[model samples]
Target: MSDAYLVRYVGGPLDGRVDTLPGLPDEPRETVTHVHLHGGPKIVHHYDLHYALEYGCEYRLREAEERDLAQD
Candidate 1:
């Protein structure tokens, strides 16, 4: 197995972004990323490993919780 592999992000702010992650798909995985909207505060997004395909792994974006939303 390779030391690192490619993963595809689905949905959310990181949608369509490809990243090189270290480790094998032997078990489930989760990842977090940061995004800064134009003229807005930085936001964090969470994703969970969903599928392992021939080309790469797919991570589905998790729904935003109350805390994930920006407080007015």
Candidate 2:
């Protein structure tokens, strides 16, 4: 299963806010690095990858089991 992640802003005008992206990839890091090299945000906060599939199985099982139990 493909994993999902949430990218949150740490500090700045957009701080404490999460960026809802179509897809989170390493592309942002590459861009940030390039900008930094050319004089940009010195303390760039990289996107944090919060694994969405960590407890995915448990959630699926819970839903399936609930349905099965209701039929019983």
Candidate 3:
């Protein structure tokens, strides 16, 4: 099964944007991905693993504890 990740924007114009995304490919790849905005659903053009890495964003596996804590 594919893993889920919490993607957080740490810097740049998109800073503070956080969303749950499906785990990327095992190997680094350059491809587009989608992100949901707080106001509404919008497409992020040309989003990819490399782009995320270059922009100071972070991706962490979605752990049970974190998910539970967030709901508390």
Could you give candidate 1's per-residue lDDT for residues 1-72 as a string of tens digits?
656778888888778999886765576465655565677777766677777876668888866663266332
Tens-place lDDT per residue, model 3, 1-59, is: 85565556433345577766676535544332345567766734333333455323353
- Runs in model 2 with CA error above 4 Å? 1-3, 30-72
TM values, all candidates? 0.55, 0.30, 0.30
Of the two candidates 1 and 3, the one with more favorable lDDT, higher being better, is 1
Error of 1 at 22 (Å): 9.8
Candidate 3: Cα lDDT at 1 = 83
Which scores greater on TM-score, model 1 or model 2? 1
TM-score of 2: 0.30
lDDT of 2 by residue, 1-72 (tens): 455445554433344654444454544432111013335645322333223432221111123454456448
Overall lDDT per candidate, in order of appearance: 0.70, 0.35, 0.47
Off by over 4 Å in 1: 1-5, 20-28, 37-39, 65-72
